[model samples]
Target: MRKAPLASLATVGVIATEDVHSNTSVQQALASSRSLRSVTAPALITPRSDGRARATRTANFVSGQTAFAPTGVRLAFSYARQSEEFPDGIRRQHEENARVAAGLGFAIPDTPEFRYSDDETSGRLKSRDAFNRMLDRIASESKPASALFIRERSRIGRWNDPRRHDYYAVYFADRGVPIVESCDPQWVDWDNDTSDEVTLRFLHSTLKSIQSRNERIEIVKRTNRGTRAHIKQGFYSLKAPYYATDRWVAWAHTREPILKLDPGVSYVREGCAIILRWATDGSVQVVRDIFGWILGGRSLGWIAAELTRKCVPPPGARYNTARVDGPWHKELVRKIARNPIYRGDLLYGRTSQRFRGQEAVLAPQAQNDAFGKILYLDFLSDPPLSRGDFEAVQERLEANLYQHEARSRTKRNYPLSGVLVCASCRRGLHGFGSAPNRVGQVRTYYRHSMTRGEGSQCPHENRYIAAAPVDSALVNIVHDALASDRLQQLVASEVTRYLDDPRQRRRAEERHACASEIRELERELGRLSEELGQCTQSHWERSLRSRKDRIVSKLEALEAVGATLAQEDARLAAIERGLAHQEAYSATLYTLYGQAPTLVQRRVHEGLIEAVHVDFASRQVLFTTRSSTLGAEACGD
Candidate 1:
């Protein structure tokens, strides 16, 4: 909001590398000239003696209206919303901090972090992307950060778990990086574990956590209560209609469910009662037919196939076209047969969130109650089927549910789910087809599915190859790469790391000693053989033969020891390489995928390789990255 010259305060030599939220290029930044302490940079700092090589605490921390922090101190701000719609408050707070940092001659490298966050996100979530990055930076030895700046402790986090709050504040500060929230009065230096300070910080953290949780709970409860109130007035807010587009007609209301402070003025309630009768619609006809078929001893699959043959659109097709596929799945048929909407009751508040993003499941009692699960008292519309008929259909459906589950469980599963994609359309290739049960042979291929149930098929041509061929091809590629000279170079560059780690370094040294001893024994055995050849005298020949046998036996034992040591040597080399590329890449291909099982190999390919595109018409497969389209090859071989 305001610009100020940064030549006034002389304190910290802060370098905002990239974004505060970024966890990349940390090791390079530690070794590179981009750090604030480098002579090439405008800032300068004398490193402290307490293990950390930058930012001493002797700098002027506070001066009247402005606060000038030491070199390598970072500020983290959690934005609060004044209005749910507009998040101008957090932006203004962040800008104000930057302006202050700028005027103090400190760098607050504006990396456009959280430039467009407010609309899509809220502060309640513990897993803030930027917050995680800040924590990662603080924890890193390569990225030397001495202190974290926050507007308030609650701004940093407001988890229901008090342990999480204390861990961030006390544990991190004890390790050297203290959280500084200048605006909040309750902020305590939890690093100084005094009875008074500990009590204050703990109490403050607990209260803030509890208050935030209670507020969120209240909001959810109020929303649910309002929805239920509306449902009672004949307009169902949660459950969808079975045969009709909307079960309760939305535009009918009996009375307002609120009390006005100004005698008789308040917002009017939306709807009152549902008078519409479900006589005959496509959805109604399907449900009626499904129940008839189930009673007549036809399977759910048979009913679904009959519906598909008749070209009838499945229920919820008008609402969600993407989810409704080419053929009717039995699950859809079961949902229609079991819906309470067909019997005129409107369901509300029947489910609660166990965890975020999970489909809210029915309460334990509701789920356990096989025959008496209908709990909602609100009757919104006239019944299509009698309650007795609905109960009978449900009883038969439940009796047959186990058989459906057994068939699904007995079906074969392919391991390469996450690996390949259609090169042309970039759609994932699904594995279909299975060998005969008694064939005793595995035969499956990953192909782009064009069937009705699979989400969006490729508009252009698609290609897929046999899974066995790709499995063989990938293993060969990985083995060759591991044996290449590139692997040796990677091992060499990371050897200097973890030098101070005495225990682990000692383990590496022992492996090295074992290799040296093996070489020395081999040289001794060579010399002994020459001595045995030179023994021409009959008296010396017997003694020489016995001595040579002893040497040969000892040499065999040493060689076996060296073989075991080789495995340890490889593991140690991998540890060194693992430290360097832990964030960027994975372990060596030999250790990871070369000797891995099919499931593990497929998972690695899915998680690592960004995309696999295939085209059947052109008979080509293309391997592409997250950013670009790369090499292409024919599908035949």
Candidate 2:
């Protein structure tokens, strides 16, 4: 729904300065009713020749008409400096622009004549000369029609951008003032949903900025080209006359004698370049050795002092500063190693102009002009330093990068503890803290399944393997397999048999899948049972009691099947071991017959050993292997 515009509206003259221009919108619409007036405040401030301000105490009288509505008309004034037409580089003329903007504000709605306040400072708002006076009228007792008027939006906030025009618009509109643009004098409605219009305006604003910036850029380029052309023609084209500046000197040259140019700057630059070239060619090693010596034990100041004592020329024969007089100072080192111009290259225009004075005045010498007299100006490139020399310096500066990596490893408490991988899953092993055994003699180990992420993806989520039993057993097995010929033969035969089997392999895969599913289901059932026990409803709870019984039965069946397979696997493993160690089997048979062997051993017999799954709780180990060959039996434990 369209909002109804305010009916009883008043027009107040406003004086908007550059800072305010940025924060206000120029084009806007207001409800034009009979209550709305074309004129605003009458000029209360009269300009004086003594550079002092004078305000007339005369009470504003509305005498002319009483026909169109009954209320007496309120008079006001709007004043603002709108200077969007001036280019950004023309800093000196901003005062003139402000005066022109003020004059235009006075011309409109002539009843309240405005005095141009050209005393505004650039890059600042709120403290502007013209804006402060207008604010006073808006704050008066009569609350006269108030709003600062400007020629355009940008002029008020010339240095800073407005956050949102609507905020400022509503701010003054609520106080009975509305900013009106001279180009398009209308009250701005900030809440208007005009995306396309705003987009077009933004684009126009961007293009204008671009055009202004490009103009400055082109002027600089032209100036440079012209200077180079004059140099090539054997003519000196210094901006300031040589005689006028204390820094300038005139001298004549003999060899390839060209033209009039400042010899002092050129001589210093060429000498610096020669030194740089020499350093690049063969003196790079010397520089690095010097840097290392400084980094190792000597202070930069000490190095500089030593160099000065040795009568070494510093930075192209330029006298070393006191800091560089004794030891190799930082400045001297940087100049010798870091200066790009020494490598026969020239860099220019690295900084932009910024107003330094209180009034924001532009200085003429904003750009770099130090390197202007070389004979081969065309040959110069940015950082004309050689890449090889620069890289050498960088290498020396960063020599400790890998040294720190090694240091960190040595400092770690358990460097290689967690880096081991599981032979079966290939996942990284997890580490538990090391502790002393109950005997306080041997070290005991703790183990947990290595895991990553959350839930099943985490290796430890399935089951945690204890370190104590597995570490002891694995060590025993490795020792036995290596030292005992019987054990080695047994392992080799079993491994080879498992690799040859196909049906055994398929059965093993199916068993693993079933085991995983059953484990998951058991977890779910346990969770559900716990939840059911917590419920309040007795009837629903009783019904769940029957369902729990059925779930238990199903779980029991799965456990039974898993147990059968485990037993069968054990018997086959003993037979394989017996066959491998035929000579030793007679002596070991009696002990094995008393108890069921672990599943890992049984699978080892059937030659289906793929992986060993250890259960930390029961000290039981299950072997995942091929399921092809089933009819094997173990002699004993």
Candidate 3:
């Protein structure tokens, strides 16, 4: 074996807060002291965001460029945040941010390969993303100086609960990347540094961490107090409005609605209006007629389809579907019959225990409302609607909601599928499979894939339908949806709107830059490849061969970079189109077509339709859309 000389050097990695904390006493101290500038600190590579009174931290900090130690050793960056709230979203954001940050560093002169990671844990010096990547980068090199950086101690890690102010400064100090906090140049003595000095640094970090946490507690207290007051003032505490359908919370400042209400509300409102219009003498009769049509012999889906075919408008007079319809589906029926809000009541709470590795679970409305129901049972009961009557009515309403439904659609896709259910059983209608095994010469039949388990108390499985027919049905539906002239106009309108967004414009610009870089990388790779081909190492050939090998390796890596950039550019383009055509397409599908298109159509239509609820028996699809104008034009009962 021949000895090899090390030629590659690792760069510095800065893990800082997203924003700078200008108001912090520490910050004030740094700003006021003239001597601070003489410290020969690492140049500010990525400035932090304003502390926002509590020093905000992002799971993945945004990337920026600046000078560092050794007068530009170059920098690589990554960030970490716990998955206690939104795991997947946080992870995705972290990974995306890391990639961007790494790319930014690569663009800097004399930069080394930058790596990224996002891990979930709170122990000091124990992050998988930070610690592991730090080890990987250092191991790849043979020097003690190549290392990682962090905004502050707490940002990287924390001590035990008892020693809440403590941190692991030595652990990272020993492995290089000796924890750079806020633009400070690498501490030469930090490696052989005394315990007392390190302890003092840790103490300062501890105080900062405590202050940040306290600030967060205060912010939450303030927010909750305001929310309680708002609740008392006849406004909802949660910002999501009954039908807003998009934002996590709607701000009073903007006065824009964004919350999506339960489809039950829409169904009841539509049904109520129709009942109100009928003669009081035959009002119950009308209900009976609907119930019989849905529960007795026909599937709720069939009845919903029939009503839609008869020109019935959905709740709020949006999207009348009687004239244009699909086949009846059980989900629409249950939504109408089992809705308590129609009776002027509210329900909330239930939670699913399912998981996707690190993904967090959102509590179901039924679970959250369980306690509220127990507390208000008597208070909410009407003279004729006793507690027992309420229970009975609930059962009857549910029964009325789902009279008949095909069972096979309930399996395959569970949690998500059940979310869209028939009102009676409140179980999602199983999708009928259509894809064929033409290559295998095998016949396919519909089969039940899920069940309600022992608690017929909730929803359950249904009978299967054949694959061939359902596949044909799907094709027809999609064809009809695509052919609708109104849908095309909607798409065009949305595309125009997408072109107007500032954020979209910024992303588009970035994507264009990435595309250009990819092209440049490809050209560079080709040149390198050609150079390697012409090289000879011995007889000038031997030395040339060695150089050529190195060049080829470099070229291959450059090609990889080009490939990544291309993928990123594609993702950005998809996002741009989605944001651009979001509204018009949704309105067109929901209003004119009377249903939100499937995931397939969504890709074709972009992020237009807000949601869709299918009726199995009636074949009338209920659509929830984002456009106010188109929604207003929809037919309500």
What ranges in model 1 sit over 4 Å off? 1-112, 115-160, 167-199, 216-337, 349-374, 383-389, 405-552, 555-637
Model 2: how far residue 24 lies from native, Å: 32
* 152-215: candidate 3 lDDT, tens digit per residue: 4444544334243333444444444344443242232332334454467556656767765665
Could you give candidate 2's per-residue lDDT for residues 1-637 as a string of tens digits?
1222342232222221111132333222222335434433232343457654433211111122111122433333445353222333233333333343243232223433333333323323546665666556555555444334554544444333343344455566566556554454433233432434445644654554455445545555676775555344333443322111112222323123223333133322221111111223223444554555644654344455555555444443323255332333456664454433344332232122331222311122222232233332222223323566655554554444344344444422221123333434545445444223355332323343433212233333323444555544443433333344554455567766874578666766766876886897788788779979798999888877877787788888877777776775676676556565655643353245224344434433334333445433344644343333222221100
Alpha carbon lDDT of each predicted model: 0.50, 0.41, 0.39
| Model 2, C-alpha of 115: deviation from truth (Å) | 17
Compute each candidate's TM-score over C-alphas: 0.40, 0.26, 0.29
Summarize candidate 1's per-residue lDDT along 189-286 as a digit string, tens digits: 33222444347656776776677666656655675565545444444444334454333233454433232122111223434433334534466666
- Which residue runs of candidate 2 sit more than 4 Å off their true CA positions? 1-94, 104-207, 213-336, 340-637
lDDT value, residue 470 of candidate 2: 51
Residue-pair clashes per candidate, as listed? 12, 53, 80
**Against the true structure, whose lDDT is highest?**
1
